[model samples]
Structure formats: C-alpha cells, structure tokens
Target: MVLPNLNWRAFIRSQPINIMSRSFAAIFAGYLVAATGSGLLALIIPLPASQSVLIAMMLSFSFYVAAAIWAFSVGTSRQAWRDLLLISAILYIFILWVS
Candidate 1:
C-alpha cells in the first residue's frame, strides 16, 4: 500500500492568504473573543466570584473555538478579518454596557 504525501507548498500557494497570516488572525481573534466574553460573564453573572470565574473559564473555550471556526470558514481573508473585528467590537460594547 502507498501512502499519499501532503504538499504544504501547494496548499499555501492555493490559499488566498498565506497560512501563517490566516492562523495568526484566527488565534488572535479567538483569544480576544474568549477573554472578553469571560470577563463580561464574570461581571454579569449572579453567582459567587469564584464560581462565576470558573464557569467563565470553562465556557470561554467554546467561544474561542467558535471564533476560530468562523474566522476560517469565511470566503476570503479580508472577510474573515472584518467579521472578527466587527464581532469583537460588538462584544466590547456589550461588555462596557454590562459593567
């Protein structure tokens, strides 16, 4: 049996943006959303501080994963960046209002 070799060079060449740039955007946006959401949740929830923090930490991972997925799923690099920025801005505004 023969195993197929992955061609990273070809994959990179075919993408609208370089893989590194895409990955960096995804990771950065994901973390920003996660952190902002966690902080907002911690402040707004009625539970004790420790429990709220714990719950925020647990739920933040899902936000991060979802943001990362959205970043990569968009049609173009520009759209991905724009969408992330827009979402982050909205979240920031909500956080400000809640605090």
Candidate 2:
C-alpha cells in the first residue's frame, strides 16, 4: 500500500490586510489618542496639577481600551484609523493650545 502525499502549503494562509491595518491602528493610533488625550485632560482638569495629571493618566487607560475595542469593532479598518487619528489630532491641537 502506498501513502498519499499531502500538500502542507495549502493549509497556511497570511492574515488579511484589513486585520493587519486594524491591529496597527489599535496599537499605535490608539496610543496616540490616549497620550494626547491625557495630556489635554491633564491641562484642563480642575484639580491640583498633580491630581489632575493622575486623573488623566487613569483616564488614559480607558481611552486606550476604548480605542483598541473600537479598532476591532468598526465596520472597516479605514474607519478605525480615521477616527483614532482625527481624535488624536484634535487632542494634540488642544494640548498645544492649552499649554
């Protein structure tokens, strides 16, 4: 009896481009949003400087988680990038304006 040869290459496949783009946006763009948003928050919060910074740092985590979830949950990776980048840009502009 002869054993049939199996093609292993057929079983392997690369990740879809959308997934990679979304992952990139989730990690990098998300961080941008969180960092800039935190900076802006730190500047504007009414508490003492130190306490405001602490509060912003804590809120930054929520922003990051929300960004990551949003990246994956959106209908398209393009939308995710647009939203995160837009928010990051707005936060950055606010930070510059405030301080």
Candidate 3:
C-alpha cells in the first residue's frame, strides 16, 4: 500500500484565495441562511422567544461584519479569519439553540 504525503504548506500557498473565498462564501451563505430562517421563525413561531428584533438585527450585522473581515483577512491570515467565521457561526447557532 502506498501512502500519499500531503504537503500542507505548499497546498496553502498554492491556492490561498481559493481556500479563503470558499471559506468566506460558505460562512457567509450559512449565516445568511440561518439569519433568514431565524427571522422567519421569529415571525411564525411565537412563544416568548428570547430573540428580540434588536438581537436579531445585531446578529445579522455580526454576520456581515464577519464576512467583511474574512474578505480583508485573505492573503494575510486566512486561517485566522476562517477560524473566526467558524467560531462566530457556532456561537450564533449556540445562542439560537439556547435562547
């Protein structure tokens, strides 16, 4: 059996933008979908919802800000931005789930 050795450094340098763009798009799209869905749920599912209009707006803003940061962070610290997006998304979901 032959094992392939993947060189991460070379891979990272070879397609920085590709990785960043895909990460950014995925994060952005995922957040947008969640936010939109939350908005719809907020309207439809009424039951002492913890998410107020102000909170929802804030979350929406945070998603946009994260995406803008992700765009700028590319070619500089793609990994850091990628982690940020992931963490933010997770936090958003956690909040939605808990609250």
List, residue by residue over 1-99, the lDDT tens digit for candidate 3: 986998877776766655665566556654654476456445544456565555655566655566555555655555555555565566557656755
For residue 64, model 1's alpha carbon misses the true position, in angstroms, by 0.8
- Order the candidates by lDDT, highest first — what do you get? 2, 1, 3
Q: Over the full model, what C-alpha lDDT does candidate 2 score relative to the true structure?
A: 0.91
Candidate 3 residue-pair clash tally? 0
Candidate 2 local lDDT, 1-99, one digit each (tens): 996785554322234767888999999999999999899999999999999999999999999999999999998788999999999999898888988
Compare the candidates by TM-score and give the number of the best one.
Answer: 2
lDDT score at residue 71, model 1, on the 0-100 scale: 77
Candidate 1 lDDT, tens digit per residue, 24-79?
76899778888888888888889999999999999999998998888778876667
**Cα deviation in Å at residue 75, candidate 1?**
0.4
Clashing pairs in 3: none
Top candidate, metric lDDT = 2
RMSD of each: 7.7, 6.7, 6.7
Whole-model Cα lDDT of every candidate shown, in order: 0.82, 0.91, 0.58
